[model samples]
Target: MKIAFVGKGGSGKTTLSSLFIRHLAASRVPVMAVDADINQHLGVALGLDEAEAAALPAMGAHLPLIKNYLRGDNPRIASAETMIKTTPPGEGSRLLHVTGDNPVYDACARPVLLEGETVRLMATGPFTESDLGVACYHSKVGAVELCLNHLVDGREEYVVVDMTAGSDSFASGMFTRFDMTFLVAEPTRKGVAVYRQYKEYARDFGVPLRVVGNKVQNPDDLAFLRAEVGEDLLVAVGHSDWVRAMEKGRTTRFASLEAPNREALTLLHAAADASYEQRDWERYTRQMVHFHLKNAESWANAKTGADLAAQVDPAFVLAEGAAAPQPA
Candidate 1:
């Protein structure tokens, strides 16, 4: 299953995402975590020391190799340079499995020790000095989009993404890529405002979004969240001294976490597990193709000097155990 954590900046999405990934890893579940946020703080949140986190390779730094590898021998793609981030995998393209051995994972994914278990993580990387004026942060996120585009994860396995905050993800079809998106909102007006925006935009696209209220200190905060989000409210996580200590560089064990916060994590995990059973590969493929065609018509065709729509394999369907499409 593919899950995303998103919300207003500083709404604790990254922290919640890290906690969820750790929870899954500690349970011995096969999982991969991708920090697709521009802030690039997931490694630190997942218990990596500053130096260790800095040493991890950035996926954005290897776009060419990733694009080339995923393109495989697909005749329609022409060359790796012609493939945009929105490029949908089709005939002869490489497909990825969660927890499977692949060159992409070998190069970009790193292991982070959480308790006695290990979690694989990848980051979209931070903007370098060279990118000061030339690049947008979304360009860096393209690598993550491509990875999710080709990935075929199983129900038992998981890929959790820490998405860029707010409605910035709606700038691209990337918002539609997840099986479930947990929108972490504090009990503030600005917090629920972002939720309204996401709900409005995602309504037509069938994005399964749930609201996870953060920093609820009293009955008022909880009531505010329930009134604003209604049935979309999944769970509310209270303040955590354990998280605060971890943030301050004072080490603490997960077992020492407050029971309520711990239960909230379990609820989030259970919600995500329920989504895994509802995976719809055909709809997933259609979404990929829809975005690919939209990009092709809008800019990719002129940019690549090819009719990029031809890249779509009409007969191709993405499903567990489905065969990769053959080149026409």
Candidate 2:
């Protein structure tokens, strides 16, 4: 299963994303935690020492290699200019299995041993001061999406992503990428507003948006979220002194997190791992290409436009008996 953590800024999405990675790893599940947020704090949230986290490689740094590998041996994709997001994979195209034994992981991923469980970590390189006007962060996000496109997750394996906060996800097709999008809303008006905006947008993509209330200090707080979000609320997390202590530098370990947090996480995991509606690959690819073309026309030149269009896989089919399409 693949999951993404998203919410308004400062809503604790990173903390929850990091905790989810720890939970999956500690359970002996094969997991990859992606820091797709521009802030790039998922590393520190995962409890990595500053130096160790700094040493991790950024996926955006290897865009050339990623494009090369993903293009693979396909005769149709003759040049990077023709490689689109949905480009079909042929022999030599790297595919990531849950076991973490693939060229993608080997080439771009860094190993982080948390507790006794081994988890792989990858980041979208932080936006630097030099990139102010010349670059779009979506390029890195595109790299993440391309990598995810090649992965095939099974029962024991999982992918967790810490997405950029708020409606910024809509800038690309990223809102459609995850099997589950865990919205970590705090019990506040601003948080609820973000929830409404995200939920409205995700409804168009048929994405499963589960609301997980964070920093619930009392019944009133929980009640506010419940009233605002209603049935979409999956779980509510209470304020935790343990997490506060960790934030204050009183401890470096997360093994002894408060029990309520653990319980909330367990419930969230159960929901994530549960069977949900499958997405239509054909429609998804087409919509992705449409967005690519739109983006290309607006900014990218002709060659980049062709490259984005070329990534579509012509053989994609919508699975029968799949969940009904969500109304756009």
Candidate 3:
């Protein structure tokens, strides 16, 4: 399944995404986890060392061959089709792999800069400055197109995109491209407030919304939110020491069951799929209130009998009180 993850920064959404990838990979699925967020921390969170995490640069590093072709350069050497790396499943884990380009070096080298090519092209090893900021980062639409092509054309059944934080235009664009969208929110009022705001806006656009409240300490807090946010589409995964899972280079179900470093991803997988089957609570949203109020208004108007029942009360009014009962 191609699932997308989105939420505010520091929401542990990326970490959660990592675990799902790991979980799928452990089951022997050829998983390709894309760090759509420019920060590119998935490798670190997955316990890959520098040498191990090094392939990401290639995935985002290359300037598209179309740019080279447009520039009238040789097409044969400019394409990154073969060099982009992918991670493979291993013994109860996953093995790492990359194809041709090394973005860490490619990004640093000056290039015939495409108007948007910003990873700062270079031809070298490490980067002292990694996230030049996504604005400064460049993605050749060709590369993204290639990735999508593979997903549709080949054997990879899963492609998980860990998106950037917030509700920017790019986030909206990314949201549109996916088959399923998962919004990660926290239990705090601020989190719920932001979540609702996005939901209302997205609903206007007809975005099918599913919510996951991460790092929850009290399930009751979810109850409170249900009163306001409509709990039918909401699910909660309790606050575990998620960072501790990252710090220890392991998972508390962060990515796999073998090591669950206080991460709630395991519950996330199940909760995400089972929300419809498991949750059954009355809605407390303003929409429901308004619906019932409108219903009551209709009921009151019906009782008035301005149109129906010939201006009659069930037992009293008879079309302007015509012919009252005489003494029997």
Candidate 4:
């Protein structure tokens, strides 16, 4: 199952995402964590030192190679440069398995130690001086979007992405790529404001959004979240000294996590599993085709000088045990 964590900046979405990833790993679940945020701090949040995290390969920097490898032997794609980020897979295209070995994973993802367990991580990379004035962060995020589009994950395997904060995720079809999205919000009007915005936007698409309250210190905080989010409130995570210490470079063990905070992680994981039962491969394929057509008509056609619509295989369905269509 694929899950995403999103919220307004400083709402602790990244922190919560890291904790959930560690929890899944500690339980011996196969999980991959992607930092799709502009800040790119998930590695550090997951226990890597700043220097070590900074040294890991950035997925955004290797988009061309990723595109080339995923395009596979598909004749619909003229070349790697012709494959835009929104290009959907067709017959002959490579589809990835979450727990299977593939070149794309080898080139971009790295394993990092978290609480004595290894967690695989990939980052969209930070925007550098070179990207100033000429590029948008969305371009870097395209790498993550493409990866999810091509990935075929099982119900037990997980892909947890820490998405860009706020409603910025609505900028592309990427927001619809998750089985569940945990919106982390603090108990404040400003925090719930983003929730309202996401709720309104996600309503049209039937996005499965649930609110996770962060930094809740008392009953009043929980009440504020319940009032603002109502039934959409799934869980509330209290402030934790252990997390603060870990963030400040003080080594801390997961076993030392506050009981309430630990329980919150368990709830989040359970909510994600529930979503998997409702997963629809047909809807997933339709979404991919819908966005592919939109992008092709909007810009990819002229940009690539090919009818990118040919990239969509009408018979394609991304589900377990489904046979992929062969090229005619």
Candidate 5:
């Protein structure tokens, strides 16, 4: 299962991600949870102390992996074995491999647990807000390309992508590789608005979108969210004390998630399973709007077409009987 959790800032995505991992691990199910958020809160949410996490840099670093891409085709991978942590505060594995034109293939080697079964963690690149031009663009795109390449050729059964926050370009580009998407939102107005933005952005990439609302307190709020997000596309999750427990060095599943908590997780599983199936689009259609098509036909009609210059300022178009505008 390749699952992705995405939403704007402060929407409880990290919290939900923690719950999902706890649930899967409790069942002894193998899973790889990738933390894509810039804040890097999944570890804290899982009760891995800040000092411990900081000491676990090798948990997600890959230097030799980067060298392979620079070496071109047939660069031998000395060992494809990803390092796994069996100890507490680091019950996960981190692996690294490279066979492409990406220096950041080294970055995809996320740490996971032996009990995490197939769980992996790839931290988002530490790019800043100003890195939107060619440099960062190609960098993240290359990383995304490498991620897909590795996944298509790997053995993992599931990939839980914790996406970077907001509707940034890197996040959008990363989503292009996902088959389905989960957008986490809150009952707040900004959450609703960001959720809608995420839906529209997902549509632009032709991927189906679902919603998960966290910190929801009232039934009416859930109703309102469902009404806006469509009943089939949304799930409501109440706040859980498990989040605080994890912060205190207890990487345990919240008991609250068992009965009522199970409901949301169950629904989430259905959504995640649907995504896990990996259905590829076989065909596509591209057509102009009917009004635009009609307008085009009218403009091409020699018998009834108005002077083309009428569509614009005649003086500007003619420019005193001048030539065409040159490319800038």
Candidate 6:
């Protein structure tokens, strides 16, 4: 399952994401945690000390290498510059499966030792001073989308991403890459407002947008969420002293998790068994190419649709046995 946790800033999305990954790892399940946020704090949430987390490499720093590795035996992708995010994966392209050998995974994955077991954690990139004026985070997250486009998960394996806050996800196609997206919403008006925005946008893409209500202190808080999101509200989490204590540096161990949060995670795990819909590669590639071409016209000299189509792998076809039509 490719799960993304997104919400308004301060809505506890990262905490929930880290907790879910820990839960899965503790259960002896194979899990990969991705810190896709520009803030990049999922490492601390996952119990990594600052020094340890800082030691891990940023995936975006190696994008050129990763793209080259994923190109594999594909003759069309002779170099990193030729393979854009919309480049469809052919038999020659690297295949990143849950438990098997994949050059893409090898290039980016870093071991995060936790609870006597090692979980693989990969980060997209950190916000840098050099990007203060020009770089969009969308470009950084595009690396994650490229990785997911090649990933193949098994029944018991999971990929959880801690996404950037709020509607910033709309800056790119990364939001559509998830099998399930947990919108961690608070009971405030702004929090529920973000939920409405995501629900409306996701409807067109068939993305499963579920709400996980955070910091519910009473019946009224839960009721407020129920009123706003209706059936989309999957679970309501109560205030957790344990988490609060950890936040204050009393301890680093996650000993007593809130019950409601645990129940929600259990449900999330069960849902993963049947939640994923196998995407049509050719269709997805075409949509991504269209998105890129639209951006290219405004940002670069690549003015024609044909210019974008040339970046795609011709041999990568749809699951329904058809190739994406090249633009004229």
TM-score versus the correct structure, for each prediction = 0.96, 0.88, 0.54, 0.96, 0.64, 0.87
For model 6, the superposed segments whose C-alpha errors exceed 4 Å read 100-107, 250-255, 277-306, 313-328
Total backbone clashes of candidate 6, pairs 3 or more residues apart or in separate chains: 0
lDDT of 4 by residue, 270-311 (tens): 999999888898998788788889999998899778888877
Q: Which stretches of candidate 2 lie over 4 Å from their true place?
A: 81-92, 249-255, 276-301, 305-311, 317-328
Please write out the lDDT profile of model 5 over residues 121-167, one tens digit for every residue.
55544445566453533234333333432233122245566677767
Q: Candidate 6 lDDT (Cα, whole model)? A: 0.75
What ranges in model 5 sit over 4 Å off? Answer: 58-64, 67-118, 125-145, 153-156, 169-172, 251-258, 276-278, 281-328
Instruction: Please provide, for model 1 over 186-274, each residue's C-alpha lDDT reduced to its tens digit, 9 standing for 90 to 100.
Output: 99999999999999999998999999999999999999999999999999998888999989888688878788888888998899889
Candidate 3's C-alpha runs over 4 A off are 66-146, 149-156, 169-172, 232-234, 241-243, 250-328
lDDT of 6 by residue, 253-324 (tens): 544676766787888776655575554455555555555555555543242323444455555552322322
Instruction: Return the clash pairs for model 1, or none.
Output: none
lDDT of 2 by residue, 12-99 (tens): 9998898888888877888889999988888877777778777778888787777776666556566755554444443344555556
lDDT of each: 0.88, 0.75, 0.44, 0.88, 0.50, 0.75
TM-score of 3: 0.54
How many Å off is the CA of 99 in candidate 2?
Answer: 2.2
Error of 2 at 264 (Å): 0.3
Q: Could you tell me the lDDT of residue 32 within candidate 5?
A: 58
Q: Model 2: what TM-score?
A: 0.88
Q: Rank the candidates by TM-score, best first.
A: 1, 4, 2, 6, 5, 3
Candidate with the greatest TM-score versus the true structure: 1
